[model samples]
Target: MPVLVFGSVNADLVFALPVLPAPGETVLAPGYATLPGGKGANQAVAAAQDGAPTAFAGAVGDDALAEVALRGLREAGVELGRLAWVPEPTGCAAIAVDRAGRNLILGGSGANQSARAAQVEDAALNPDTVLVLQREVPAAENAALILRARARGARILLNLAPAGEVAPEALRALDLLVANEHEAAWLAGQLGCGADAASLHRALGVGVAVTLGEAGAAAATAAGPLRVPAFPVRAVDTTGAGDAWCGVLAAALDRGLPLDAAMRRASAAAAIACTRPGATMPRAAETAALLG
Candidate 1:
C-alpha cells in the first residue's frame, strides 16, 4: 500500500551560530544554507528515498520556489500527480541552530494556507493507503484531509509536530500516532491522558509510537508496550532525523516488515541521516548497508 502525505513545503533558511542568542539579544553567523524543508515535504522525501509507495498531495506556489520544491520531490521518487499550484508565495522557514542541535525557528504560511476546499475534496484517496499528516499546513486543512481520508477508508498515520489544535477524535481515528517524547506529552494532555504509556494507549486505542531521540522509541499496543533502542552514530545535523524516521517507518510497514523490526530500520536510517548534512536522507545503498 502507498503512503499518501498531505502537508506543507517550505524553503528552510538556516543560520549556524556558535551559540544561539537569548530573546532580545543578537548573534552573528558566518554563512547561511538554504534547503527544501517542511515536515510534510521532508517526510515524503524520506519515504520515497527509502522506497515506500509514496505520493505527496499538497499545494505549492506558482513561483520559482515551487519549481524547486517539485524538483526535490521528483528526485526523491514521490508521486506528484495530486499536487496543485496556489497563487501565494512559497512558504519559508528561518532556522537558527547553535553549536548544539538546539534550534529556533520562525515560519510563514504562504502557499500552505492557500490550499482550497475544492482541492481538499479532490484528493485521490484509496482504502488501503497510509495517510500521513504533519502540522505544517493549516489546521482546518489538516482536519479536512483527515475527514476525506476517513471517507475514502484510508489508515491514518499522524506525526504531530510544531503543535496545533488537534481534537481527541482525531487521535482515536489514527492507526498510528508517531511522536517524540514532548509531542507525546502534549498529545496525552490533549486527550486527557496522563502522559504515560498506558493512558496514552487507552486514549489513542493502542497503536502509538513515542520516539525519544537517542533513547530510542516505545510503542503502545494491545500486546503491551514495545521498546526499541536507537542505533548509535556520531551525530552531525539532526535537522530532518524525525522526518526520516517517520518516513522510513511508514515505508517499512508498507513493505510488510513487523512493527518492531520496522522501528529498528527506521532508527538506523535516522541515525544515518544524522551523519549527513542537510535534510536529505542517505541513498538506497546506505540504507541497505544499515539494514544489512
Candidate 2:
C-alpha cells in the first residue's frame, strides 16, 4: 500500500524567541534557521519515516528555496515525481517558538496556490492507497482530489489545519477527518453542529479525529468513540506534532491496523515529534520503542 499526500510545500524560517510577539510587537531571537516544512511535506516525511511507501504531490517555485523546502521529503525517501515547478516563489513560513514550545506561524502560499488536483495521477489512487490532504493549498483543489480519490475507492484522510471552507460533498467523501481542537471548533461552527468529535462525525457522515495537544486525542467513528492519551515527553518544539500524528495514522491504516490501534501509534509518534526541534519525524523503530 502507498500513502499519497497532495498539498503544500514550504521553506520554514524558525526563530527561537523568549516569547512570541504580540500584535504590533517585535521580539529578537539569537539566531534563526531554515527548515523543510509545511503541513503536507511534514506529513509526507512522517509517513515515509514510518516505513510506508509515500508520494508527495505539490508545487514549488523554480528557485533556490525549492531545494531547501524539499530536503525533508527527499531525505525521508518520499517519491516526488508529481511535484510541480511554478513561476511563483516557493511557499514560505515564518515560525516563532517561545520558551514553552508554543508557536506562532505566518505562511505565504506562493507556489502552493498553484497546486492542482491534476498533479496526482488516476493510477495512484485505489483501494489500497491512502490519500492525505491539508488546507495549505487551494480548497477547491483539495475538494477535487477528494472526489477523485473517493471515486477510486482510496482511503481519503483530510487534516483540516488552518481551517477553511470545504465543500459539504467533499467532507462526505472522506474516510477520516483530522483536526486540532481549534480547527475542530471552527469546522463545527461551519457545519452548524457541536464541537465534539462525535457531533462532527455525525454531521459530516465520516470519522473525525481531534488532536488535543497534551490532553491527547479523541475520535468518533461508526465503530465507536476512542480516546488516546498523549505519551509523556518533555516538549522541545510542537510545530509538527499534529502532522506526525496524521502521517503515522495514515501509514498505520495502510498497514492494515484498525482505527483504534492506528490512533495509539499516531499519539506515540506525535509525542516523539514534540521532543524534537523543527518539523522532524520519528522513524518506525523510535515510534515503536516509545509506544512500548
Candidate 3:
C-alpha cells in the first residue's frame, strides 16, 4: 500500500531571531538556514522514512529550488510520477522563530497555488493508496483530489494546515481531519463545522485529531474524545515535528495498525523529529528505537 501526499513543495528560508518582530516593527535575524521544506514534502519524507510506500503529487518550478526539492524526496524514496512541473517559481516559506518554539510563517504560493482541479481529476487514484492532503493547494483542488481518490476507494486523511474556508461538500469527502487546535477552531468557525470538539467529529463524519503541542493531542470519534499524551523529550528544532507525526500516522494506518497505536507511534516519531535540526525526519530504524 502507498501513502500518497497531495500538497505543496517549497524551498524554506528559516531565520533564527531573538524575538519575532511586532506587526509594525522591523527586526533582524541573527542567523539563517535554507532547508527543504513545505508541509507536503515534509510529510512525504516523514512517511517514507517511517516505512510507508510513499508517493508525492504536486508541482515544482523549473529552477534551483525545484532541483533541491526533487533531490530531497528522491533520496527519501518517494515516488515522483505524480509530480507536476511549472515555471511559476516553486513555492517558498520564510520562517521566523524565536528562542521559544513560537514561529511565524510567510509563504509564497508559487506553483502550488496554481495546481489545477482538472489535473487532479485526470490522475489515476488507487484504492489502496492513502491520499494525504493539505491546505497549501487551493481548497477546490484539494477537495477534487479527495473526491477522486475516494471514488477509487482510497483512504483519505487531510491535514488542513494554515486552515481556511472549507465548504460542506468537501468536508464529507474528508475521511479524517487532522490539524492543530487553532487551525481546528478556525475551520469550525469558518465552515460552521461543528459546535464543539465532539460535535465537530459528528459533523464532519470522520475521525478528528486535534494536536495540542506539549499537551499531546485529542481524537474525536464514535466512542468519544480520547486524549493522547505527548512524549517527553528535550526539544531541539520543532520545525518538522507536526509533519513527522502526520507522516508516521499515515504510514501506520496504511500498514493496518489500529488508531491508538498509530498515534503513539506518530507521537514518538514527532518527539524524535524535534530532537533534530533542519527538518530532519527520523528514518524507520530511528522511529523503531523510540517504539522500543
Candidate 2 lDDT score at position 138: 94
Q: What's the true lDDT of residue 227 in model 2?
A: 95
The C-alpha lDDT values of all candidates are 0.79, 0.94, 0.81
Name the runs in model 2 displaced over 4 angstroms: none
Best by TM-score: 2
Q: Where in model 3 is the C-alpha error above 4 Å?
A: 117-124, 191-196
lDDT (Cα, tens digit) per residue for candidate 1, span 1-292: 3887888888788888888789898898888887888788888888888888788877888887776666667888888777778788888888887776667788887988775434544445666677788887777777777777777777778888875577656666777778888888887777777776567888768488888888998887787777889888877678888988998888888787888988888888888988855676766578789878
Residue-level lDDT of model 2, residues 1-292, one tens digit each, is 3899999999999999999999999899999999999999999999999999999999999999999999999999999999999999999999999888899999999999999999998989899899999999999999999999999999999999888999899999999999999999999898899988999999988999999988889999999899989998888799999999999999999999999899999999999999887888999999999888
Candidate 1 vs candidate 2, lDDT winner? 2
C-alpha TM-scores of all predictions:
0.92, 0.98, 0.92
Model 1, residue 287: distance off in Å is 2.3
**Minimal lDDT window, size 10, model 3:** 115-124
Q: Write the per-residue lDDT of candidate 3 for residues 1-292, one digit (tens) a residue.
A: 3798888888888887778889999879767888888888999999998888898888988888887666668899898777889879999888887776567789998989877655544345777778888888888888777777777888888887877865567677777788887888887787577634576797777788888879887788776677778888877678888899998999999899877888888888998988776577899898888888
Clashes of 1: 0
Candidate 3 vs. true structure, TM-score: 0.92
Per model, how many backbone clashes are there? 0, 0, 0
